[model samples]
Target chain A: MLLMIPGPVHLHERIQLAMAKPMIGHRTKDFSEILEYCTEMLKKLFGTKHDVFIISGSGTAGMEAAIACFSKVKRITCIDNGKFGDRLGKIAERYTEVDVVRFEWGKSIELDEVEKSLAEGSEALAFVHNETSTGILNPARELAKIAKKYDALVIMDGITSVGGDYVAMDEWGVDVAIVGSQKCIGAPPGLCAVAVNDRAWEFYNEKCPFYLDLKAYKKKLEDWQTPYTPAVSLFFALQEALKIIEEEGLENRIRRHRELSAFVRKWVEEAGLELFPELNEYSQYSNTVTAIKMPEGITDKELRGELKEKYGILISGGQEHLKGKIFRIGTMGNVTIRDVVTTLACIERILVKRGIIKPVLGEIEA
Target chain B: MLLMIPGPVHLHERIQLAMAKPMIGHRTKDFSEILEYCTEMLKKLFGTKHDVFIISGSGTAGMEAAIACFSKVKRITCIDNGKFGDRLGKIAERYTEVDVVRFEWGKSIELDEVEKSLAEGSEALAFVHNETSTGILNPARELAKIAKKYDALVIMDGITSVGGDYVAMDEWGVDVAIVGSQKCIGAPPGLCAVAVNDRAWEFYNEKCPFYLDLKAYKKKLEDWQTPYTPAVSLFFALQEALKIIEEEGLENRIRRHRELSAFVRKWVEEAGLELFPELNEYSQYSNTVTAIKMPEGITDKELRGELKEKYGILISGGQEHLKGKIFRIGTMGNVTIRDVVTTLACIERILVKRGIIKPVLGEIEA
Candidate 1:
């Protein structure tokens, strides 16, 4: 089955079978051994030597923890480009005083705007490395550099970027990088992993809620345990997925993503449908799935339904104002060139059949 | 390895193999189908037609959500018989304006006190059926009846009781029953399953926080979906565990627990160790692991550490004020009579070596 949605991607059978197995006690020496090994492996995946803590919650939970832990920072600057960016601002606002710098939907966040926002002497800046909603990827490293100039901590929402892209957590000057299992990790959701730099640990120790407190997670992770009952089954799958990632090599994994994204981009151009995202310095991982702005009379949901119901392809529909106007196809994690080609071919057939795009004879490569 | 802890028993290769499988999409039709069936099966396990909603969190998450959703309650009465009961009170205090009825750490909750507390006017009375921390099980049915008399809702913390004893949800008039997958359900600890009666639903709809909102969970559960990326792996593990419970028959499972608990009780008596809990009203599932009150200079932790390190057998020490004052061994789950006998023998050896208790004269039953 084609799984082109932003998350809950098609997983390998190893992960599936792992979920069906018996569980070990979290406090047992055996589970701790696995937890210790998995933590070390994830640190390698995150490109951090500091520490990787796993929490049994969604990505939002991790975000909440990050925001809550830095309460000493009186003002948190949130870079709002799309849906996820707006959510970060909203969550930060709930717990801490936050200032949001907004941008138009489907637009890449300008580094200059962030630079100007940081001029206010805010405590830190929060930005989404990959905005899954509009397929816009911010230049996180550049933003991190700008934030560093102001001596501010940079929190990157690398939820969709980490494994699919070259995040370079330690090399990028990113203080805190948050990622989820469901996205590029190619595992099920429910496990949110956050890597805290030495500096961020200081922030965490001083300011945070009890549960979202980073220091608490760190202390627990040191013992190779979680503060709560973790998603052990998910942990098993991640161990396997990370092993596969290691075998492929991080650079090779990123290269595969780039190849698949480029293939997807080629098809969109051939279809002559305008790409929704302004792809200036966008995410290489997802390549920012394009919204096919069809002929004026075409119905967006109908096309999506045709592909999903008839062809059994599950593509993501647009959110909010972009609803029924855009359909996104993710290109990440175990998705090969062949998978991309077939999916695009099916999509092209659906478009031509719907009379939205003129059928070009043998334009699609099988 | 000897695992006599309350949960996370020594898993068979089959259950461990089940957990090793990969994850599936939570929203996709495939995951929804599996989730739907799991929900139905859980309803059967709980002996209720009430809607079952699964959250990807620890059993405490279920308790928090239950408290969070029942936001309209003017006062929730938390009955504390032991450590777990006290923990429930602590959690309820976070969301609901709670009224707590206290009992001594190892003492049983008096039905008269509970009935009197209900008369004081509370919207809900929350109690832990099996207080694993102190191994004291409250009379849930009688409390449920008394709570119903005050026009109050009944929420039972069945984290250690649901799968081990008789939990007649509808028959016992329980409005909300919270369960953890790790205990009697015989799965890993990720998802929390809750059964909410209609009256509880009304309260849930009135003022629940959006994320912990039971109404939201109910909507998703109906369609076999979840609010967030579920602990996909644990869900399937739970599915298999529930199937085992069904095949064995609920009565047979409960009887096994009772027999095991009785066997452990007999061994403790033969060893001349004093039981910590009220024997008149014991948890049929887990006989309160007694505090030997150690002879002279011996500490519980020192003895427990030696037993674990020497024999690779793990037992639990007491919590809070009771820590290092008492030791606990839980008899429940897929554990057999042989395991009970083996654990008692291990304890006997540990006690004799430490000069805390005299070595047994007769051999234990296999």
Candidate 2:
């Protein structure tokens, strides 16, 4: 079976084997060595020389940690252009006063609006770098520059973007950035890596959840250990997955993601379908997933169900209000051109049979 | 190498192979079915027909969740007899005013002192059912009875005791109970199962950490899903481990744990070693792990180091202030009489070579 969802992506055999390794005590020297190696590899994947902490929960847990630990301001500005961006705002609201700049799903963020909100006593700016739900990559570099002008700390959710795309966290002045192992890192779900700039410590709040407290994580990392018992097997799998990333250089891996996503986008256009997200000068299409608008007559159940039952392929449909309107095809992690071609071929077969598009000469085999 | 530590005990080949299974999206029907099965199995293991929520973090995360979600009182009584018991108090202090009834590391709790503390307007009682650090099983039933007399909630940390012992949570009136995957269940670490009685919901606090919030878990369980993306691979391993427990029968599993712990206790007596924790009429020895006093003139480094280096056996030494005074051997989840006998033999050989014990005729082979 093929997994083409935004996250919990396909796992490599090496990672699966790593996960199967015998259990070991987390307090032992052997486990500490593995933690150290994984921490260093995660630093490289996050594009930061600053501290990176591995958490045992999902990407959403990392998102909560980033907000709860660092949001010590009177008010924070959150930009919500999609599902994940909205989640950032919701989590921030729980910690402090939040000013959420909301946008329609799949629509681009307005830079002026973000700046204006930050100007109104907002001491921090929280947003998602890549909105996986809508297949749009927000302008992280430009947003950081704007936040810097207002002297606001910048927190970015790089879960779907970090390993698969270019994320210059330190260069962009991102105070805190988060990534999920199941996404572009190609490990199983349950681990989250959070990178923090040294300056971000100034905003640390003691009221953060005890288990997700950043201060505890930083202190424990001195000995290459997690504050609490980590999911040891997940760490093993993550280390192997990061090693795979190291083998194929980060730049090369990013190129692969870009190429595969581009292939999917081209196929959508050739097959007479429209891209889901609307982009501006700063906003761009996500390099890890491609979202296409569903045709007028095809229902989500019919299309996705047929794909899963008949072709053994799994992809995600639109979430929340966009349900049945857009379907997404993920191209992150260990995805190859062959996988993308097969998915596109299956989609073409379904559409042609539904009378949504006419079969082109030689295109069916291609 | 054998894992004789309290947690992260020896895992079976079935559980390891289960961890190696391919990834699946958490939102899919296939994954939901797996979640439903694991939840039902966990309910039985917890000995509660109430709601059980799975969190994708360590047991400590579940500990914090139990305290942060339910401690909505003027003051809560926390029992501190060992490392984990102390942790319960510390986490509770973060949520509410805490009255900690402290005891020595290897001493048992006094029932009268607990009643007096609860009498002073403490609306809840938080304690560890099994103090893994000192290898003592606290009197969970008696403590719950005391809390019920004062109309207080009962929160128990059953991390190392739930699967290996008879934890009648419903009968004992335990409002909230927690278990870890790395303990007697013999699954890999990183997942925590929390069972919440229906009445406990009345004490729910909105200030709980977003990632570990019990309310969110309860709401999501209606759809047979976790509020956040779970550690997918760990869930697979846990399901397999729980299946093994089902096949073995819970009563038989508890009996095995009890018999193995008794065997260790008998060996300790014959070797002229003392049990670590001083027990009372209500308190008892743990069925999962055995704590033994270090012999005179034998340092922890010498005894444990020799076991690891020469025998490839892993055991735990005392923690914190008791660092060199005691050593613990675990007999939980898939551990057999042969494994215990082999460990005992290795310890006997080390003691004889160090002149700490005399080699008796026919006893060495036994």
Candidate 3:
């Protein structure tokens, strides 16, 4: 079976085996070594000299941790262009005063608009670098530059892009970059790694909730431990997945993801389906997930159902307002060229059955 | 290797295998079923008809979730006896007006003293049923009764007790009981299960942190989902562990734990070591973790190191104030009589080698 959803993608075989490793006490010397090794590997993947802390939860937990711990300013500006971007705004609203810069669901965050919002006097700005909902990659470096010009800290959600796309937290001047284990890391879900720079730590609030406090995480990291019990098996899995990434080299892995994304996008165009994000001068498609407009006659349920039931392949549907109007195919994690080809073949067969496309050269028989 | 720590215990073979199960999309029908099935199993294990939700973190996360979501009243009473109880108090203090009822470590909460404290008017009462630091089981049923008499809600930290000790949440009038996966459930560490009654839900606050909010958890639970991405592999491991518990029957499993505790206590007495908790009319020993008074001749580092290096066994030392004074042995999770016997044998050898105890006839030979 092929798992092609946005996250919790099919894990590599080594990661699965690593999950079965014997349990160790969280305070033992063995665990301390594993924690140190994993932290070093994560720092390399994040392309940052800043500290990285692993929280034992999903990506949202990482997002919340950033908001809860880093939003110490009087006002926070959140750029909302898609579902994940909107989520950032909502989470920031819970902790501090938020100025939401809203955009259409399928569009990218315009640089001029984001700069204008930041110019309105904000202490920190939060945004999603890669919007998973609309399959659009926001201009992270440009936005971070603008935020820095205003002397405002930048919080970037790189959950879907950190391991798959190019994310340089320090180089981009991102105060905090949030990442998840199950996306491009090819590990199981449950761990969220946040790359935090010195600027963010300088503003750390002592009043932050204890469970989500970054200062506590920093203190525990000094001891090579977490403040609370972490997902031990998931840590083992993440270590193995990072080892695989190191062996393959980070640049080559990013290139492999780009190749897979290009292959999927090309196939979609050849099949006469429209890509959701407009390929314009300002727009950049995500290298992890590709959103495609559903054909007029094919419903999301029908297309996804046929693919899942007949071919054992799973894809994602549009979330929130765009539901049923668009479908998404994830190309990140352990997904290979073969998996993408198989998914495209399944889509072609489903489209043919729905009378949206015609089979060519004995395609129906095959 | 014997994993006799407080958590991340030696999981059963089936649970370990479940951790290796293939990944699935969290929004898929397959995940919905697994979520629903695991919730039901958790409710049964919690001995409650209340709603149960699993958060992808450690027991500390569950503790904070309860404090963050349920402490919206005028004043909360936190019983602070040991490290974990004081932690509850500290978390409560962060969110609401907390009246900490302090007690000495390794001593039970006197019912009269608790009643006197509750007479001062409180909206809620929070305490740990099993104090991992002191290895004492408080009088949960009676203390909950006193809290209910004052029309205050009861929040229980059942992290180390749920699956090993008998925990009748509904019978004890507990509004919320927090449990962890790696303790008595014999699963990997990642998930925290919270059982909440209707009364607790009535007080759910909109001001609660988004990631730890109960209302969002409830909304997602209705559709058999979580508000945030959960640790999916950990859920699979928990389900398998719960299945093992169901097969053994909760009563039988509780009884097994009791027998293990008895065995360990008898062995400790024979070896001339002292139990940490004083057995009195109001005091009860925990069936999960047993704290033993460290002898004068041995240091925590020396004793634990020798055991781990020579015999591949892992136990726990006390936390904070009790760090060097007491050592702990966990009798919970998938630990068996053979494991206990082996640990005892290893301890005997180490003690004799350190001149803390003398070897008997055939002891050295064996």
Candidate 4:
């Protein structure tokens, strides 16, 4: 079965075999070598000169680490334009006082509002670079620039954007950025890589949660080790996945993601469907996933369920309040042009069967 | 190569193959069914009626969760007799005020001292059930009983002991217990199973680290899901490992661990080697691993290095100040008599080559 969700995406056979390799002692030289290689590759994927620590939890764990370790200010400003952005705010609230700038699920955040909030004693700004839930890519570079003017540390959740899109973390002055293994890196779930700028260490919270403490990770990386026992097999898989990323070249991979997502958007328009996120000058469509409004006359169940049961394809439906109103097609991590075409074909077939739209000539074949 | 260290032990072929399985969406019904199965099997392995939440991390993360979530008190008494025990105290100190009762490594803690410490306004007691570092099993039942007398909560780290030994969490009044996938469960490292008694919920700290929060785990378990995206491939491997445990029968598995450890002890005596831990009536040697003092004519390098270079076997040496003073053999998770015999033969050959001991008749064959 093909996995077209935002994460836990389709796995390559090489990665699967890597995951099956025998376990080694986490403290051994062999494991350390693997850790070092993965760390180096992750630094490339994150576009950072700083150290990127591999955490043995999901992406949200990395988000929590980013906030709990660096949110040492009197108040932090968080942008909540979608589910993941809202999560950043929630996690930050647990660490310090938070001022959450809220927006509708598929709407872009106002830059003036973010700047105003940061002006009010907020020492940090946290936001999601690509909001997977709403399929919107927030203006990370612009936000980081705004935060820099206010002398506020910028924390970005690059989970769905880092490997698949252009995320120049160091160039954009992102103090802390996070990515998930199951997304563009295309390994598996359970590992989160966090990149921290050297300057961000000044805001480190000594009382941060022990398991997710970035300081411990940094100190241990000096010896090519994790502070705690890592999921050794997952590391093996991640190394292989990173090798695949390196082989493809970051620029080429980003081009593929952009091309596929643009293709999906074009298909939605041709098939009489609307894009979910309301795009503005600053906000753009996510390169990794496309959220489309459910076409008229076809229920979400009829559209998604038929795709899964009949075509062995899995796509994601809208989450939270947007449930049943939208559908998402993820084209991240090892996704090819053929896979996208097949998915579009299946969606078109389902819509045709439901009498939602007339079949377009040559579009299904394309 | 054989893995005879405390964890990341020898993995069965089934478990490795299971890890190679394709990824699945964490929110899907199929994944939830797998989660439900693993949770039930983990409950049985932990010998508890309470819920067991699976965290996608190493065993140390589980230890941190146990302490951070439940150490909400004026002072939590932590036991520090070995490396793992000291870690429990260190993690507890970050969340709450801690009174660590220190003891010499491999030495039994004084029960009277523990009682006195608990009597001094401590509201909880945290300790390791199996001190894998020194190959000793602390008196978990007795400690829980003592903590109960003071009406304090009991938290136990059963990382290396839960599946290989008899750990009756509910019966022993253990408020919270943790186990690792790599140890007695016979899976790869990466997943940690935590069992929480219903009564332990009252002490839950809302400020606990967001990623490792027990309350979030409990709430998500109601829907047969994890709070965050789990390590999907690791969960597949763990489920397969749990199946192997169920087939072996918990009582028989514990019996095998006990018998193998006893065999190791007898071999130590026959080889004129001393046990590492100073055992007492209240303290016993660990069933999952055996620690032996370095003999007279053999350096740790000569013994362990030869075991690894000449013979394809891996064992653990001492940590911290005890480094080079002792070596440990782990017999947890699918360890067989033949494996033990082969390891013993290798050790005997190294000792004889180094002029440390005379070869015994029929012992090498056994």
> In candidate 1 chain A, what residue range of length 10 has the lowest lDDT sum?
A282-291
- Candidate 1 per-residue lDDT, tens place, B1-366, comes to 666777765554556666555444466777787688778877876779888888777777777777667757788899987877777787776566878899887777887887877787778899998888777767878888888889898888888888877788899999888888777767776778888888886676343333455776777666677866676666667777777787888889888887787777666677777667764552332532333334345677677777787876777888788887777886766777777767777778777876767876366452
For candidate 1, report its TM-score.
0.84
> Per-residue alpha-carbon lDDT of model 1 for A215-316, expressed as tens digits?
767787777777666767777777777877878888898877767777666666776777677756633324524344444556676766777778776778
Ranked by DockQ, top first: 4, 2, 3, 1
In candidate 3, what are the lDDT values of residues A177-206, reduced to their tens digit? 899999998888999988899889766766
Report interface Cα RMSD per prediction: 3.6, 0.9, 1.0, 0.9
Instruction: Score chain B of each candidate by TM-score.
Output: 0.92, 0.98, 0.96, 0.98
lDDT for predicted candidate 2 compared with the true structure:
0.91
Q: Could you tell which candidate, 1 or 4, scores higher by TM-score?
A: 4
Which residues of candidate 2, in runs, are more than 4 Å off? A359-366, B359-366
Per-residue error at B350 for model 3, in Å? Answer: 1.7
Which pairs of residues have clashing backbones in candidate 2? none
Q: What is the lDDT of residue B40 in candidate 3?
A: 95
Candidate 4: which pairs clash? none
lDDT minimum window of 10 residues, candidate 2 chain B: B357-366
> Residue B239, candidate 2: how far off, in angstroms?
0.9
Q: Chain B, model 3, TM-score against the native? A: 0.96
Per-residue lDDT tens digits of candidate 4, residues A216-297? 9999999999998899999999999989998999899999999989888888877777999998899999999999998788
lDDT of 3 by residue, B1-366 (tens): 689887879988899888888887888778888899889988987889979989998888899888779878888899988999999998888788889888889877888877777788788899999998898999899989999889888999999999999999999899999999999989899999899999997667667777788788899998999988889999889889988998999899999999998888877776778999865587699988999999989999889888988899998888888888999999998899888888888888999888886644233211
- The CAPRI class of candidate 1 is acceptable
Per-prediction backbone clash count: 22, 0, 0, 0
